[model samples]
Target chain A: MTPARRRTRSSAALRVLFAFAALIALTSVTAVVTHVVNTSAGLIAIRGGTESAATGDAAQVLASWTLLESMVYRSVIERDAVERFPDGTRIEFRSWLNPAFITGGYSADPTRTGVRGALIGSLWLIVIATIAAVPAGVGAAIYLQEFSAPHRLHRAMRESVHLLAGVPSVVFGLIGLVIFARLLGPLTSGAIFGVRATRVPTGRTIVSAGLTVALMTLPRIVIAAEQAIGAVAPRLRLAAFSVGATRWQVVRDHVLPQAGPEICAGAIFALTRAVGDAAAVIIVGASTVVLTDPSTPFAAFTALPVIAYQWAMRPDPSYRGLASAALLVLLLVVVVLNVAAGVVRLRARRTR
Target chain B: MTQDVGVANERVDTLSTEELTVTYDDIPVVSDVTVGFARGEVTALIGPAGSGKTSVLRALNRLHDLTPIARVHGSVRLHGKDIYDADVDAFEIRRRVGMVFETPTPFPMSIYDNVAWGARMHGRPSELDAVVEHGLRRAGLWDEVKDKLRQSALRLSAGQQQRLCIARTIAIDPDVILMDEVTAPLDPISTGKVEDLILTLRPDYAIVLATHNVQQAGRLSDRVAFFLVDESRAGRLVEWADTDSVFFAPRDARTEAYISGRAGSDMSARGRTG
Candidate 1:
């Protein structure tokens, strides 16, 4: 065959292979989604009574499978109700999008396991963690990248920082448990500041958890900030220097301004990790069933990931639904944060 | 302006180097080069690549301090004071002697802020607007950028950016200005504009320009210093003379051959003579 004909044949074969691969992916995704929905619906049916439970479970399974519920009703399940199969197995299809699911305080009772407190707690955790980590991380990065001499000590310092970033989150959690929870209990619990101390001196409060998360995030932020600061062109610094600006002046006016958006992006990424982290918070003693809003950073708190982890560990179908809903919320928060960071990065690029 | 010109010229030596040697990582690039810049006059350093013209210019304002490996020996005096003295602050020296680079580097800020940054760093000037306007006008960029002062400096074209950099350098009102091939990367038209700016600025500030472009050195400089890399690849001053004499009756054979475009082979031959 001619080269053109051979090329066309090969191209057609490649297209066919791509189409086959796509079909396989689509099939696997559909299968997994169907299995999840059917299993949830089946479990709900066993708990729900015989009459409306079966109808609701059937409708839910169909809705989840077809994705029609989202398009039509903007939800997977419309209301908290029960239905049953002919054999007397029951199912409960709770509306995951209900305000009560998000706003109600946590309880052992699956119906009252609202994520409001956990959501608020996660937000506080991220905010406090970001506040504590960004400056410290960026400062360390600046020192290492700009000010520090290229001597053996600085090289060792850089290597140590990289090593810190590679350390497991559990190690940081252990540190938090020992230091923030045990050693600095009075300070973290605000007992030293003359505030009313109602709880034990375990320091298993929002402040402790936030600090732990901050420690977990610090290494990542420092590495990212170093890269961002390093990415700035040397000529820009020289330009600042030539204008008679001091070292600090050059860094503040030129380096920081140019690297700010990227640093922010890195900080936000670290915050996202802190927000989703469960292992570290768990070790630091964050509760999975917080019933009230944390009034202060010193107050005991639980985060969304902790709550989701708790629900996921349960065998109950309702708990599974709650966990799924919590995971969805976590996903939404991450997406929103990323989009905000993207917008900031674009604005920074435009200005530069 | 007329009175300022007369006052500026009255000070004969604005800045001078005494046995200046610059080493980067223990290797000397500029060795024992002594030169003086007269007030209100343009002094040009002309050389082939790697002859340390730019390095010498940088050393004048303590720009070498920024490079960790760079070690500057000997004294650089500004107004008869050793700038490199232990008690002397490099920051103060840099403020008094501003510099422009081969490439335009405006700060990532508004055009107005880019020009005003130097003044602000010195201690926020009370008359910031006037300073920005004066610097921009002096660099020949005010008419184009004045209406859009709030716009980002990076948005300016390459030539405008270079001029903005010049404006930024001049904003602090330094006693001397160092230009290291400031127009090398620009188009001929932009080079002409910058050359015109240098000529216009000659009456107000002591200017040290480093350029390999022989015609540019001859055109704008009152005096020209020829530097060459010896067999050791260390830059040494070959000749320093008035522009007229340097171009017409060069005392050094190397300088003469360099001006006549026959220096390439002569330079390699002279490298063996070292």
Candidate 2:
């Protein structure tokens, strides 16, 4: 080979070597930091005589590297270790995630504290929010992108919707508080609907909270959906039009189906935002300590984020550990949502 | 040129436009154009770029209504009915007058669905399979695509996609088929196939084709309307006559200059020479 070719080969090899070194360094630093954090948190819990401190550390380390939290928890439960602390306090190691932990209602008693009720309530909130937002958002997007005339009023409406997306979630919560909780109180609480059941005492129930989150994320869905619809080729619209399709038929048959994956992705994004939202839910009077499953839209509700936030604010070590576990669950939920979005996008691409 | 209008009325023209003017945002692109298309005949609208050839073809089927700024004046009559009347639905007008665009545009669907889509819009027809087969065979695509009818229309070659679009138009069974530079983007072989398809389709549909290819126009059209951008940059009909007369013995000097290679040259020089 020529000198230049040889030099090029050496440079390429050097680049590969550098990239390998960088990846190794990154992994080592991350492992060292995680180990330090887990060890310190564990030692502090132990000093405070928390029963599940050691197991919690093991679970955290396992969760950090892999999906082995359940295995560690199971091992700890089976061992049933009883150890005496320096202060002569006897502690028993136990699994933090049990069926009772997943399904039971909240309790102020630390031993019985679980997020099952909150989890169910949050899921219901997502369902309600999706129903409230998706249709309205997608419809508004279709109107703006496909049918709306290019006039000042329509332009202003578009700009206002875009502006609404940037507004704080708390502001929407305030709007929900006034409109849903107070103004529509009787209607939402099933008093006017003739159900004769008021689960929240006040009208600040899951219905109100769900609507609040829906309002908060409506603009995001509309913008995403509009962009998706707009991205369809002008040729496709022309083709459909040339074939004698009406405005509604063309949009329903060609435009909406093409934009489906992006619409779904946007809905998932709205759900992710709603799932982690605490301030709006709090303002809309989602109970901080709900003890029963929300059986209906009129029922009182709490979500994992609220419980996690409440737990983190407490001055107890065990409460902080519970908060960490709750955060892990929230992260898992977000990952699952993103994976679902990916599958939808893949299917959409394949359809074309 | 005016003599053709009298003859146009004498014959049972399938579709006709009277003094049709198309404007976008109040600027006229096609002005005061009177044309008629007879059944079993190809009428080619031959013009330069920006001469409003596509606009005129689009106006025939009311496709310009989709553009927010476009405004079409005068009447486009299909089967003696004024399509621009307030009570007339544009969709119904389009159902009678289908169109094929310059670019191939197959819907993002299966080949069968692409052809069946138009027929199914009213409701499911009892002989749906027969209709799809007829449309595909008429467009000369059935032999190539018969085995993979379930495949996505997008997976076809560029030429095949254009043929699929033709099949889709034919499936609707329109009285008049508007083709806006339909073969402009195709290869020579594909263009040949499409040109053959257009000739085959001429027996049943009043086909109005707009194209920049003078040779293709001469090959396919029975009568040709030559449009030119005037001093105002508004497209106006310079000459409309039989294709042989227009191609060989043109009446208008501008039509001759455009048909020849001297279209963009100094008009004043040609005027002084004449």
lDDT of 2 by residue, B1-274 (tens): 1113325446767788899999999989889999898887899998777777888998999988889999999888887788888999999888789999999999988999999998787546897999899999999999999999999998999899999999999988888999989998999999999999999998788899999888899999999999877777778888888899998999998888877757734543332243
Best by DockQ: 1
lDDT of 1 by residue, A250-346 (tens): 8988789889999999889878877898889989988866667888888888888888898889886566767877776776788899888899899
Candidate 1 chain B: worst 10 consecutive residues by lDDT?
A: B1-10
TM-score of 2: 0.84
Q: What does DockQ come to for candidate 2?
A: 0.70
* Native contact fraction, candidates in order: 0.89, 0.87
Identify the runs in model 2 with alpha carbons over 4 angstroms from their true place.
A1-104, A193-199, B1-9, B264-274
TM-score of the B chain in model 2? 0.92
Per-residue error (Å), model 2, residue A124: 1.0
Candidate 1 ranges beyond 4 A from true positions: A1-92, A96-98, B1-12, B265-274
lDDT of 1 by residue, B42-107 (tens): 999998878889889989999888788999999889878899889999888898899999989888
